[model samples]
Target: MSLTLEQRLDTLPAGAEVAWCGQQYVTAGQLRADVATLAGWLAAHPARHWALCLDDAYAFTVALLACGMAGCVAVLPGHRRPAGLEEQAPYIEALLVDGDWSSAVLSFPVCHWQAVMAAPLSAAPTTPWPAPLSVLMFTSGSTGVPQAILKQERELLAEVEIQAGLWADALAGAVILATVSQQHIYGLLFRILLPLRLGLPLAAATCTTPEQLQAAVRGLMRPWALISSPAFLEHLDPDLSCPGARWLVSSGGPLSASGAALSQRCLGLSPVELYGSSETGGIAWRQQHGSDWMLLPGLTLSVDAAETWWLTSPFLPAGQRWALSDRLVWQENGFRLLGRADRVIKLAEKRISLDEVERRLRAVPWIAEAAVVPLEIGGRRCLGAVLIPSAEGWRLHATLGEGRLLLQLRQALRPWLEPVALPRRLRCLSAMPVNSQGKRPYAVLKELFDVAIEC
Candidate 1:
C-alpha cells in the first residue's frame, strides 16, 4: 500500500523545525507527540462525533490529521451559524464549536478541543486503513436548502498528486503561505494538504490581514508561494510589492486581466489561475500570461450536444463522464472557460449575460473588482455592485451616485450596459468578504449591506 499521509510524514527530516509564527516551533517528533497527546484526550468522547469549527491552518491541519487517525470525522457543516447547520448534521453525536459562534449546544457533553488531548493515547490507528471520509462541506441543495458533500480520504490524496504533478517544478521543495481557510477545498488542497502530503515545510501563519500577508512572507525564506483567492489578490497591490514572494496561485473566482497585470507589475511574478469545482478536483489551469488551460494531464474530454465539454479522468470513477456547470470553448487539444451556466440572469425582457457584463466591467478604468449580481427588489429585477476600487477609487464611495461620479458611471457604461443591467444599488467598501474557498459568499455580502444600503 502507498505510504499513508501520516506514515509518509516520517520521510521529512525527523527533527526539522516548523515555525508557525517564529514563536512556536514544533519538530516533526514534537508534532507527532502533540497529536498523540491531543488524540489521547479525544478518545474519551468516543460516543460523540465532532462538529468541528477549526479556522487556523496549522491547528486545522494537525487537528484534522489527529481526527482522521482517531476515526472521529471532524465534520465541517460549512455554515457560520452553529445550531442551524448542527440541527441537520448527519450522525452528529455532539459539537466541538469555536467560542465566537459557539452555542449552549455543547452543554450536552460537548468537548472543547483542549479536552481531546487528555482523553487517551490510542496509538496511531494502523496508517491508511481505508481512511474514512474526514470532511463534510455543505452546498446549496437541489431543493434550495444547504446540503453537504462528503469528501473521502483518498480524494484529498488524488488532488495533491494532480496539482503537484501539474505544477511540480513550482512546488518542488517550495513552502506555501496562504490567506485562505483550511476548512474549504481550495485552501485545503493548495495550502494545507499538498505540502503535508509532500512532507514540505508549511507556514503555520494563516495570514488574514494584508499586513499579516506581507509579514508572513517577509518571515519566510525563499521558494515560498502564496496560495490566495481572487479577492485577496485584488485588494493588495502594495503587499504584492514584496520581493520575497516567488509566485502566487489564485482561485475561488475569476481574476481579471487588469488585476493580473497589476500583480505582474508590482511583483515580478503573475498569479497563476486554477479552474475547477468542489465536485471534480482541479481540471485545467492557466497562468496570467497564458490564454487557455493546459488541461490536467490524462483527462478525457468530449463535447455534449450543447457544445459544453464533458470530461472524464482517472481521479473519478471509471466511465463517469462529468458534465461541468461552466461552459467551455473546446479547441483541437485545449479549452477556455466561457461563463458559468448558472450565472446568467434576466432583466426586463432583456437577458443580462454575465460574460457581457464581465467584459464591460473589465473595460472600466481602475475598477479592480466587480460582482454584478442580479437581485429582485419588490419582484422587479435590479443589479447590485460590490466594487473594490483601484488606488484612485479610495475616496469615492461616499460621493458616488450623487453627482460627478454618477455621470462618469453612466458615461462609462452607457454604450454597453443596458439600463436594466446597470447597477441600481452601488456599494463600495475598502475590501470585499471572501469565504473559506476564496469565493465571494453572496449571502454574506447581503449581510454587509444590510445596515448601510437601501434599494
Candidate 2:
C-alpha cells in the first residue's frame, strides 16, 4: 500500500536521493536539513503570505514544504515578470526567489535562495504540520485576466494519491523530468508533489528546448518519465534520440493527433493526456488511441439542462458541486469534450462559437492552426483570426500575395459559416502565440489586430 505524503516524509531514508540539481544529486537528508533551516527562519518572521518565485524545481519544492512547516501560506504567481509579480505584492507580505531579483523593483521583503540556504541548520521538527495548509495559485489567463485559486493541502494530497495509485507500475524506479514550469498547478503536482510522494528522484532544471531535453535524457542511466505539455511536444526534433525514457505525460491543453504521433515515434511511447484546470484538480485523462476522457477515481460527473458539466470530487469542499465552463458529450464510462461555453460571442445579433470558427478554418487545406478572438474596431465589434499557414499555404501566399490568399480562405469558409460569423480580419504566421502552458492568451490574441483596426 502507498503511504500518505506525511508518512512518506517521516519514513523515507535519510541517505536516499531526492532530487538532481545543478549537476549533482540531492539526498533526503539535505532536503530535510534545508527545510528545517528555512522553516525556522520563516517561523521567526511575521509574514503570513510569502510569494515563491523560484526558477529551480528543487528550490521551489523546498520553499513550499518549508512554508507548510512554518504555518505560512505560499503564493505561486503564473509569470516571473516584474510587472506581474508587482501586481501580487498587495496580497503577499514577502517574496522568496532563486533568481537574481532587484530590490528596487519589488515592494515586499525579498528572501534569496542562496542566502536562506547559507544559514545554519536547525533541528528538524518532530510535531506534525497543521491539519490543512493553504497554497495560492493562479489561472493560466488563457481566456481572460488571471484569477487566483486557493487550494488546501488535503485537496492537493487527494489528487496526488489518486495519480500515484493510477500510474504506480509505470512510475516505479523512474526519475521525473519536466519541460513545464512548476509555477502552475499541473507542473506543481506532476513534477514536484507526485515524485516526492512516490519516492522518485526528480530533475531540478526545466527543459525549455529540444536540445536540453535530449541532453537530460542522455545523462540519465535509469528509466525516466517526462512531464510535459503540447507547447514543447509539438516542436520536438524527430532526429533526437531519447534512451531510458519510459513514460510521457501531457497536460495544460489537449495534444494534437500529429503531435501525439510525433511523440510516439520519438519517445517510443504515446503520451497520456490529462484534461482539467487549476480550479478543479485533475478530472479525466485519455491516451492517444482514444478521444474519450475517463474520470479519475473518486469523482462523479453530471450535466445540466444547458449542457454545462458539473463535477463532484473529493478534491472539492464537502457536498459542493463545481460547475465547469467546458461543454461535453456524455458516454457510459467517459465523455468527449466540446469547446468552452465562454467561447461563444454575439456579432450582428448572431451567436457564433469561436471554437467552431477556428475548427472550420483549420479544415481549410492551407491553414495549419487557427485562433479566433472578438475584436473591437472603430467602435464596432467583429471577429479576427490568427493563423499558422501550412507549407502549401505559405507557398500560395508567396505566389499570390496576401489579398488573393485571404480571398481563397474566405471562399473556403463560406460553405459552412454565415457571412456575419466569418473572420473580418486575418493575420498569417508560422506559429501560434502559445505560453509555456500551451495556452493562447485571449488578450494577447486581441492585440494582434491592434496596429491596424480595419484589417
Candidate 3:
C-alpha cells in the first residue's frame, strides 16, 4: 500500500529537488525546513481558519502543509479579487499570502511566508493531520457568489491514490509544469499533491501567458508534464514547440477537437482533459482521440430520470453520493457528456436549453459565436443572445440596423426553435467575457441584457 502524503513527505530524501523557480531549484530539505518554520509560527499563533492566498505554487504548498500541521482549516478562494476576499474575510481568522495584497483591503490579520521563513525554526514537527481535517474551496457557480466546498483529508488522499496510479508510468520521474492556478482543486491535485507524494519536482511559478509557458518548457530540459486548462491550450501558438513533454492535462473547461489537434502537433502529446467539479473531485477523463470520458477508477456512475449523472466514488465519504450537473449517456466503457442541467431553463411554461439555442444560432450563416441566456426584462423572463459575428455578420449589421439584423436572426432561428425559445433581446460584441479558467462568465453575460441597451 502507498503511504499517506504526510508520511511520504517525512520519508522524502532531503537532497531531491522539490521545485524549480526560474533557474533556482528548491530541494526537499529546503521545502521541509520552510514548512517546519511556518508550522512553528502557526503553532504559536493559532486560528480556527486561515486563508491561503499565495500566487506562487511552491509557497502555497508550504503554507497548505503548514496549515495541515497546525490543525487549521485553509480557505482557498477562486480568485484574489479585493471584493471577493472581502466577502470571504468573515469566515477566516487570518490570511497567509506570498503575493501582492496591496489592492485587497481586509480586516483579518495578514501574515507573509517571508516572515515565517525568517522566524527562528523549531525542531521539525511531524504530526499527522486529523482524518476529518476539512479544507474549504470556493467555486463560482452560475449564480455568481462563490460556493464553498469542503474537502476532508480522506477524500484528498483517495484522489492521490487514483490519479497517481492512473498516470504512474507516464509521469514517472518527470517534473510538473503548470499554467493553471494551484488555488483550484484540479491544479492543487495535479500540480502540487501528486508531485509531492510521488516525489517529482514541480515548477514554482505559474506560467500565466504563452511566452512564460514557452520559456518555462525550454528552461526545463528534463522530461516534464504540464497541468493546464482549455483557455491556455486553445490559444497555443502553432509555431510554439516543446518536444520533451511526456503528458499534458487540461481541466476547468472543454477543449475543442481542432485545438487539441493543433496542440498535439506543437507538443509531443495531446492534452488529456479531466471532467469534474469542486464539489466532487475528479470524476472522469478523456483524451483528444476519444469522444467519451472514462470514469476514474473506483467510481460507480448512474443516470437519473432526467439523465443527470450521479456518482459514488472513493473521493466521497462512505455511503454518500454526488449528483453532477452534467447530462450524460453511458456507453459500454464510459460516457459522453451532453451538456449541463443548469443550461436548461423554463420559458413560457416550456423547457428550453440555452446550449440548444446557441447551437441553432451558430448554425446560421455569418454567426461566429453565440451565447443564449434567460434574462428578466420588466418582470418577465425572456431569452437573450450575445453574439460574436463573422465578417459577413458585421457587414450585414452595418448595412442593416441592429433591430433589422436581430429580426433576420430571429427569422433564421424560427425553424429550429419555438417563438418562446427565440431570443427577445440581442446584442453583438467583438468578444465574450471569459474568466481565467476559459469559461464564459454567465453572470456578466446576463448583465448586458439587465441594463438598458439602445442596440
TM-scores for all candidates: the values are 0.70, 0.76, 0.76
Q: Write the per-residue lDDT of candidate 3 for residues 1-455, one digit (tens) a residue.
A: 65765677679999998998779889999887888777777777867688888888888888887777777787887565554577677678888887566654578787776776766778446766654456898754544344577888778878988898989899988889998878878888899989987889999898877788788878888888989877677778888887788888988766777669877877868888998877788999988646789989899888677766789998887889988877788778688887776765545433466777787788888999998878877755788899999999999989996788888888887645657778888888999889999999989888887553422
The candidate that achieves the highest lDDT relative to the unseen native structure? 2
**Candidate 1 at residue 269, lDDT?**
75
The C-alpha RMSD in Å for every predicted model, in order, reads 12.2, 11.6, 11.3
lDDT of 1 at 78: 45
lDDT (0-100) at residue 427 of candidate 2?
79
lDDT for each of the candidates? 0.64, 0.80, 0.79
Give the C-alpha miss distance for residue 109 in model 1, angstroms: 5.2
Question: For model 1, which pairs clash?
Answer: 38-117, 40-120, 41-116, 41-117, 41-118, 41-119, 42-116
> Over the full model, what C-alpha lDDT does candidate 3 score relative to the true structure?
0.79
| Count of clashes in candidate 3 | 0
> Model 2 off-target regions past 4 Å?
1-4, 102-104, 121-125, 140-145, 343-455
Q: Deviation in angstroms for 13 in model 3?
A: 1.3
CA shift of 363, model 3, Å: 36
How much is 142 displaced in model 3, in angstroms?
6.0
Regarding TM-score, does 1 or 3 come out ahead? 3
Write one digit per residue (lDDT tens) for candidate 1, span 1-455.
34556665555576775435455556677667666555555555564366666665566666666676666776665444544444455646666643354444533355555455445556554345245546766544222244556666676677687777767676665667787766567777888777766666677767766678666656664667788776566666653556666668887667766668766765567888887765576787888544777787777778768866687875554557678777777666477777667665445423355555655665678678776666667745577676777776655645564345545665677554556666666666667788889988888765554443443
Q: What TM-score does prediction 3 earn?
A: 0.76
